[model samples]
Target: MRAPRDKVIITCAVTGNLTTPDQTPYLPITPQQIADSCLGAADAGAAVVHIHVRDPATGRPSMALEYYQEVVERIRAKNPELILNITTGPGGRFVPSADDPKVAAAGTTLMVPEKRVEHVTALKPDICTLDLNTMNSGKEVVINTPGNVRRMAKVIAEAGVKPEIELFDSGDIALMNDLLKDGTLKGPILCSFVMGVRYGFQPAPETVIYARNLLPPDAEFTAIGIGRAAFSSVAQSYLAGGHVRVGLEDGVYISRGKLAASNAEMVTKARRLVEDLGGEIASFAEARRIVGLAPYSATRAA
Candidate 1:
């Protein structure tokens, strides 16, 4: 039961890893307000934005490499082919010393696996997020081991860059199948199964169909849900066949506890639930050829 409009890859996530502006005033800090909310979430129906930067005067969360080279050169200076995904899960969160709970707490937590992805290997962003195994990221306890996801997937596959692999529970999808059988992840393996984050993994429909049956038949995936389970897992990840992520970086309300003014109105309400489930939304160069990405470079990206 996983095959509808065929290619549905939305993936917005314009700014996250921490919501500020006192938890939701449309949280997109500087670098031109995250490149103007990632160019209005890639013209509503985002084909892949997923960035994270902040610190426009203390909004916080910033591992500054010139604010990720000016928000990936202002979203490739206006969609020069925008499939930019950048976030090495912002270092790694690890709060400890609550009455000496084994000391280690200075706010911007753990940054080691090559300084937790040195600004995605110096802005080689066509995709970057190697947070393959680290749990309990609510208010501490996140440790991406497997020797830091095999040293940040071997420097994001020697700077060719592409490691989405962010499975949060069901054992991090067997640590991304042991980083794809230790060849250190390469192939079409892009994953994201972020359920609610209090303890991680809890958005149901059987946890998005057991994280799409622990994908390992040449995996390619996406599914984000938090805060009212993002309208039941973005229509349950398009009824479990995969692909779909939304904005305000994992929802900042759009009902019940309402408050979602923009982030291109959360990808225009996730492209009206993927055209009311008849699904058809993968643009930005067909989501860079359905996420193999390697083409959009408007004049060497400005």
Candidate 2:
């Protein structure tokens, strides 16, 4: 794919599935809080808001369709133009039992493919994530087997929502290629190259460039650097001709040893980087055109 020369799309991942409130007090838990944060990020120049709902009381990641619906409704009510990208990648975790090995241990969140994409089918957002590979995302394994990925891809396609093919390492690009060739996925494809996750791909300039080279001709990609590598990855992604993502979901700190005050703060920093590097930030309408999403009104009606 050709590099986006004139505009950069900044995506803010409002709240992720793994991080708890204890880790960062600023994490948005309630649906209202998540919606507010998304509005704040958009105001601060984020073209898209990537959402993952959580249980308000405990701050645990939730797959409840109601939570997803409420969050989307709230965000849309406030800022109808901002692109919404919800996640379907949260319920695939697998932690093996210590004794049996085959049995799922406590904290395992593995679900059937249908259940994983339930929210996407119910609430048709502008975009949804489709993690392309299964790998260890810490102590637990995120099981996205090829069979399940194919199933989920079909479902998401049927729903008319664009899939952001998420990749943790260069090897996962093979699966992306397979999906593209098999007609399970279509162009212009959207991919997220997630870096610095433990046991996944490392966050580095070479790693980012390597993944960029592996993308298909019609694909548009974003690079997200988790934790300390977040800002660095943002800079590198822009330099490597891809878009950028930043928020509490990927990292808590705005800089060395400083926790980001909010998702908007991180986005503000990302916007600065994009502008300083001679690239203009894409507005919501521009992002919609770049990603090939339907109009906001049509999306809501769908």
Candidate 3:
């Protein structure tokens, strides 16, 4: 088992692809709202903010480059020091048609892997998620085939942005090792165990330990709990030598009954959890150094 970290990195996923305004009225739908939530999370204690934009009018998940550009620009204008980890996870889901299982249904978003990372290529955020799972997510399937993952990785690498491998299960971790071995991905990698997704990795203390053991010795990781496991995973992850993540993207409830007022509120609870466990939250510079990323100014020059 890995030893505990000296400084734990708290990453706040301000908004996600699947969460909707109906789930919580506080969900950040517009670009301005998303940017404001991110800055608030950073101030609350998150070193890194994982972003996903949505349609302003419909509040549906959007892969529009302009939306992403606006969010990144707004975040940079206010807090260049805060790490930006954008999502390239929206366009990989496949919904098979009942009439023809081989054909895609209305919700299918599978597209050229290059199209998925277009914003990452353009904005060149400090980090972007590279989902490595091809699993059954509820009624739909999230497909990140090995070949497509390589294609996406190539675009992310070309952009000079670090890809935080999002591992949904143990198999994804194995695939990550293979990618690292083949040079499809670089070493000292950053990854996260996305627990509590149905049919994927379940959240538990032992689950965290098992996934942690499978990672490369030098790899950095975070164990993120989705839904009810959200806050619990923060303590579990830190005690097991990994970092922590929490936000609206992962879950909405701050306590047993109440919904979180904002993304910053979630981060506040996560910070207290880590501190209660005797872990120190990593600062902006500390997190950059830990993840092997350059400072904001240096990244801008590239």
- Among these predictions, the greatest lDDT belongs to 3
Off by over 4 Å in 3: 298-302
**How many clashes in each candidate?**
0, 0, 0
How displaced is residue 240 in candidate 2, in Å?
Answer: 0.7
Lowest-sum lDDT 10-residue window in model 3: 293-302
Candidate 3 per-residue lDDT, tens place, 1-302, comes to 68889999999998898788889999999999999999999999999999999999899999999999999989888898999999999889899999999999999999999999999999989999999999999999999999999999999999999999999999999999999999999999999999999999999999999999998899999999999999999999999999999999999999998999999999999999999889999999999999999865745743
Query: Can you give the TM-score per candidate against the true fold?
Result: 0.31, 0.97, 0.98
Model 1, 123-241: lDDT tens digits are 88888877765666656777878877787788888888888888888888887787787788876688888888888788887888877787875577877897788867888888777
Q: Once superposed on the true structure, which residue ranges of model 1 sit more than 4 Å away at CA?
A: 10-46, 52-62, 78-92, 102-208, 211-239, 244-281, 285-302
Residue 132, model 2: lDDT of 76
Model 2 collision count: 0
The global C-alpha lDDT for each of the candidates, from Candidate 1 onward, is 0.79, 0.89, 0.94
Between prediction 1 and prediction 3, the one with superior TM-score is 3
Between prediction 1 and prediction 3, the one with superior lDDT is 3
Q: Order of all candidates by TM-score, from best down to worst?
A: 3, 2, 1
Candidate 1: give its CA RMSD in angstroms.
18.8
